[model samples]
Target: MILNDFLPVNKADLLKLEWDYLDFILVSGDAYVDHPSFGPVVIARVLLDAGYRVGIIAQPDWNDPNSIDILGEPRLGFLVSAGNMDSMVNHYYVSRRHRETDNYSEGGAMGKRPDRATLVYTNLIRKKYKDKPIILGGIEASLRRFAHYDYWDDSVRRSILFDSAADLLIYGMGENQVVEIAEYLNNGIEVQYIQHIPGTCYLTKSLENLDQYIEIPSFESVKNDKIQYAQAFKVQYDEQDPIRGKTIVQRHSETYLVQNPPTMPLERARLDWVFKLGYMRNYHPMYEAGGGIPAIKEVKMGIISERGCFGNCSFCALAFHQGRIITSRSHESIIEEAKMIQMDVDYKGYINDVGGPTANFRHPACKKQLKVGTCKHRQCLHPEPCEHLDTDHSDYVELLKKLRHLEGIKKVFIRSGIRYDYLMHDQEDAFFYDLCQYHVSGQLKVAPEHIDETVLDYMGKPSGKLYGQFVKKFDQINKELQKEQYIIPYLMSSHPGSTIHSAIKLAEYLRDINYTPEQVQDFYPTPGTMSTCMYYTEIDPRTMKPVFVPKSNKEKAMQRALLQYKNPRNYDLVYEALILAGRQDLIGFHVKALIKPRTNVPKAGGSKKSKSSKRKTPSSKTSINSIEKTKKRR
Candidate 1:
């Protein structure tokens, strides 16, 4: 493959192809990494396979209108996306501080794309092509399609379609929606009139004759009344399925934002086909000097074995974007991708990852999901596993064995979450044995966000007892295999239901395990999550009961400090937190004490894990059920 093989990024390449006009120009926030893992590249490839001429404008100078003119105007339209991640999340930390680097940009540099990139890129396009159709897709637009709270702004905002002035917004995976859109636009249908497509949101003046849609609440009501906001989010959250979902309407001022039900996910064979599209599978060569795109390092060798997630954690946005249904590529498709990895000049004899949202989930949670759809208000493995839930991982085990046996493949690692709760539910141990024996590198990472029952209930994770059971089994398996491996449970601090007491309990558990977390993720209330609804409304939409949200920055800081109480710098805040919670008993010199007393008061000596302690994980019945965001995978 040569430079021309990749889609044209500039007019010179278009000239080299001897093309005078283009069909669609994809403008994205992320630096172009032409691989299936990137949404923009996948959409562009899908369109190209459908025989449309496509060009990409990646990380163009947003301030310069002429910068986007490099590709000129396309005959069909322009596709605008915030790339794989939400732009604001890409640019800032949860604390609202500017991030030092942009993983998606070349050299991990910040400012490659502006904040709220889809809106900015659309505006840039409008400056020159006033009448051209501009369509929005990707995580940013998908999650922000309806009127919702904005974390960085700390206020409710209108739908992105209303604010960005784009012609239409594709809310979910756009392979099906974009092709339908391309066909309509190619047939000379106006963008404003292309309102009937599933998974597309549009602005309307009247609801006349639109009797099949559900009107949750007006933007003004949701913005002014917190209760209304929670109720609206609940409706939006409930109707995400393609089978049972209805058209959703939320009015903003005089106009209405109408989101059609999500498009059905691609069948397994078609999903397999989409991955085999001719992709360069690397960042553009022009970025080589700047160390290529840092984001690609984790994904370049990994294969997206599946899409969609049934393990819907409350804080995760997958249920909103990918929906609750699960879909996967065939073993043949994945094995083919691994062969490509073997051919790469950068191959290091290891497959970085072979997983998706939940690696072990290769199909729908149950056979009923294939026919009717996912139940709106229920989860598969949280609270308790449903009787209908499928726990077989034999197919996954077979797939992994085939991958390990491939030529030039030294080891195949399962990096994308393993869903240990789901694994524990299985009666057979083939997958569990294989996961420990073949997949694990040095350490296996799992997310048990918090151990407090109250917090775990709010988080929709399995019981703490379940996590303890998983840890025991993991240790036993490693022992049986005679390998030294560790389980690093991803921990969270200051979530909606967590209190100072809860934080202390989590800290005590860490102390018992003799583990010091190198990094902790504070709760970030981004849009499209039930947790964010609780954060803003202080009420659980499901039961409409009062939820205790740790909103004050001071309390949030103290909770975070409690998670890392062993650090010398956190002594002050941890001391204050302990006193406020009336738990100063934990500050003494006993081995069970969390921190040392101040002023050289014969301070509590740091304790080591006894041999028996090393044999087990923290004993909080549900302490290590981490609800990891898996932010890097998408």
Candidate 2:
């Protein structure tokens, strides 16, 4: 049975009943959204498919101990995870600025700290069942696998494995590693035995046994003495000695046991858990709270037909977490899900997103090239596009056509943002025409982060010319179809390579297109992500060196405010921004003239004292009038 099967029971009452029943209960700190995060949901589904009973606790309040009992009870099984999406309240919205420094966004520190939350959650479980396994995954646990700087606390913290009291901390992708852990536990293998498992971290009372093994130095040690770790890690995976993997020694009490490359899961196996619909509950609950229609409540809904894309945009984390290789679902499974959504009464008449990462890019381009063992290119986003890489639109066209003919489905839409550059590669332009004539709800979203070629190059995005070409083609199609649909472009500002000059160029592009977009985003750096590290430290983790750093606050605010040029308040910000950019020549021009210049005049001392503070002198006439009134009363 799936997790939603227990919804009929009262959550408070359910907490009071069972103390020790569930084989494994997974708790998530993040609101269980269908976004790639429901990794625990995926992991739980996989375990259930393997014939083990599993349950999930989504968005449990760590501050409330009662929420822990909702999982029923912990038993002899594994607790898997990726940590909470937001470590604290401040992390959720970038709009909130720090009190002291009008510059930095407030660091995430409002909710219960992860280690403390885990401690409280684990103690509740231990009271019911002693020594059950608890393991942590996700970006938080993975990046914090070793000692690292804590910007919130302003100090280095201990390893999360030691702090959270988890049996093990799985680092990278957990598909293969999680199963290995479960099988070992089922055979009555002690948690200690799995310490050597690759892509995982475990704790022991002493480091005696691991001394013989290859040691990977902590990030702190590398930061203090870069020469040692850089040289060690620079050795290519193949060139390194077999016995001694790329192990960097640093001067610290802790060390890392660097493993070889990670193991990837099969496409078929990953898709199996997805069709079971474990994440449906997670996604629905949030939409209900937010006063929006959940996917299940809608007339029609669909899951991604695939995982991962090879676009490798610098600002995207999907490529990092999901990997560059494309993993697709069988065509039959996707059609079946569409049919199921159509059957639901809530189905309004729309089929939501039916595609994955880069919706239209279907098959892996590198599969054939890799088989020949002659692949020389590291990335497909380079200047010279791969000749073998098939930028084909046939598969997407076929999928959309098939989806449109499904029973009882009225409108099939492509809601997920599409890569316009890739869409431009449609050989016959049939898909573009079909999309304009049939799909889309009057607007198609596309991401063109900036118009500057240099910034575009650094971001690994298509040239500005590519977006323009797609727009022109799309416009022609719309005119032919007599449709009033427009393009809703998604733009990112203050990315690592973007500067004030680049932002101005983007603003000019927006103005030229006569597009006033409300959907503008400032880049957010999440843990373990390449962009996040580059944003914070200005150092690339792969290279262990510095890169071009941009002034985050001023540049970010300017970018975000560009979409609101017509607003009067934006004029104040725009003027101040121009002054900061040293482009004072542009000040008091255009809309900026409406904003009054700031004044620094001091307040008068007389006005500072209020009227009530100055006592009034009572006249003799007032005293006589008071006496007469007293006499009349007597």
Candidate 3:
């Protein structure tokens, strides 16, 4: 028999395929939700733009190998970035709910975005083409480049490279680094030499190279111990150094690896691999199966009119992550995307959302110092509008009118959530009139986190009156047009500046307006964000000072429960909140009649696994005997 007869059937076929016929395929596991991500699409776009033949495998089932055949098998090494979005965060409700339970280590975790799909694809690639390279990137691979303190699991885990068996791990934005890898391989370089590329973390066989690697020093405190991990995790950026480097676990015991200060922002590329033409497939399953909101129902397929945001809500990370400079897509591209959506078999006469982080805030309201050669680091509203700033809404007005005229599109909706503060401007008022008349289907979501000035200030909101005036104007416009859409204002509770008193005021406002919001968001601190850093570190890295932190759990829970006070069971929470806030007058209301003993145990952490120290997850004892025992204890 020939030597080929010794090989497995599938492997024998792959071994005989000509390398010249192979296409450079980049598969993204990220859900194509129109947001920039750290998945395969970003890299795929780059390779495609560079003239390399590339195809994407989005949200593929990693468990199934047949999915790999969609790209037609002529394959270069696989680009296996897990997902563009964090898998854990996707499973969360509003992000503030708890995640762990005694039966499982990390329940409620929206684990593995398109990345799991990528991992599966990569494994299949290896199964066929034995020596082919498989690279992993994105948040899951990046943050856990080394041993990390997983709070929910309450243990230190091995690197994802070890777990996924990927040949390489491209940690940060895999832009320049990925390009270098492609070029190196094309030029006949081995994978070993390509590991030298910066912005990546990989394993080496020699221990001698350990000292040359970055060190975290503090990582030893938390390994094998969850509480120490939580404490160590709480440490903030060392302001003494300008770089703001990340702390990592070292290769050896009792040592930590601290990376150099964070690198400068990667210049925005013409196309990002994280976002592709059709990446939404990645999120379809989880979102369909998700709690409360469904992506199928929420997203109706529309083009993004703009990129980035300007609203600097302190609690929000959009401004920092996406940037404050607003970039509207050329009207031609948007119209083309709209035309494509009309051709979809699933077209439901409604275009889901068609705006950036904030729909109508189309242009940069303020002229930033970055545009000019010099820097004038001052607020736009501080004194008067600066010389370079043009606070105008004329362009957006024209664009809206043009879109309305498009044919075959049943209804165009603006549901990205609007910044009411910006909408209250002079030119913007007329625009709002048109928006209320045409854009809004029935409900317009506006975030008014809290009524208290202090809380609003903390959230970087303009004013309570701004929202009130907009609502009144919206109503007036609806009356004139003889339509029936209403503003659905989003409210948040237990934010940083919130108190029991402020919560009562918010509840009272809801009562007065007779507006019980369909959703109430509670503040959650995510890792590597400014708000989380503030909450955990208690010091502003910019100012080098401490900030106030309300350390009362009772106060926090009461504030959160106040918004849901209509239920008789919530009376205990609402009554206590009012009394704590020194508004005892509210105690005599229907809130007093529903006082009952608390049955549910208080849950902590988030739907995402907490990278904290070992903490026992609460057991859900539903058995009748267990219930009776629990009831007796209560």
Relative to the unseen true structure, what is the C-alpha lDDT of residue 108 in candidate 2, on a scale of 0 to 100? 19
The per-candidate count of clashes, in order, stands at 11, 6, 25
RMSD from true fold, candidate 1: 7.1
Please state the error at residue 102 of candidate 2 in Å.
25
**Model with the higher lDDT, candidate 2 or 3:** 2
Compose the digit string of candidate 1's lDDT tens values, residues 1-634.
2232789999888899998988999999999999888999999999988989999999999988899999888999999999999999998899999999998999998989999999999998988999999999999999999999999998999999988989999988899999999999999899989999999999999889587989998999999999899889999999999999999999999999999999999999999988888888989998999998998888988999998998878899999999988999999999999999999988999998989998999988999997899997788987888889999999999999999998788999989988888899999999998999999997999998988998998998877778889999999999999999999999999888888778999999899889889999999998899899998898889888787777766778888999999898888778777766667899889999988766432324656544433442122212211111111111
Best candidate, lDDT-wise?
A: 1
Report the Cα lDDT for candidate 2: 0.57
Error of 1 at 283 (Å): 0.6
Work out the TM-score per prediction.
0.94, 0.75, 0.66
Using TM-score as the yardstick, the better of models 1 and 2 is: 1
lDDT of each: 0.88, 0.57, 0.54
Summarize candidate 2's per-residue lDDT along 1-634 as a digit string, tens digits.
Answer: 4443322122443455442355567765543444333465566666655655666665455566676666555455546443433343224445444322111111212342343344445555555556777777765666555544444553445566665667777755566677788788878888767766655666544555544444555556544544433333333211122122332222245433333333342465556456655434334342354543232232136557776666767666555355555667777777877776666666777787777767776767556632432232355644435655677777778888888887777888887667776666546787788889888889888887778786677677888988898888889899999999888878877676565556666766776776766767777654434455555555554456654445435546665675555566566555545454445654444643322444434458635544423423223333233234323433
Question: Model 3 over residues 1-634: C-alpha lDDT tens digits?
Answer: 1121111112223346322344465555444332222244456655654555555555555566776655555444777655544444443433334333211011223433332343455677677667777777665566555555332343455555665666777755566677777888788887765655555656554444434433432344445544443344333222111123332334434222333222233333332222334433222232344332233234447556665555656666553334455556666666666776677677876677778778876666555423431122333332223455555777777877777788866677787887676666555467877787778878887787778775676566766766788888889889998998877878888665555556777888777787776667776654334444445444443343443333344555566778877776556556555544445666543643223333434346544443322333223222223223323433
Query: By TM-score, who's the top model here?
Result: 1
> Cα miss at 326, model 2 (Å)?
0.8
2 or 3, greater by TM-score: 2
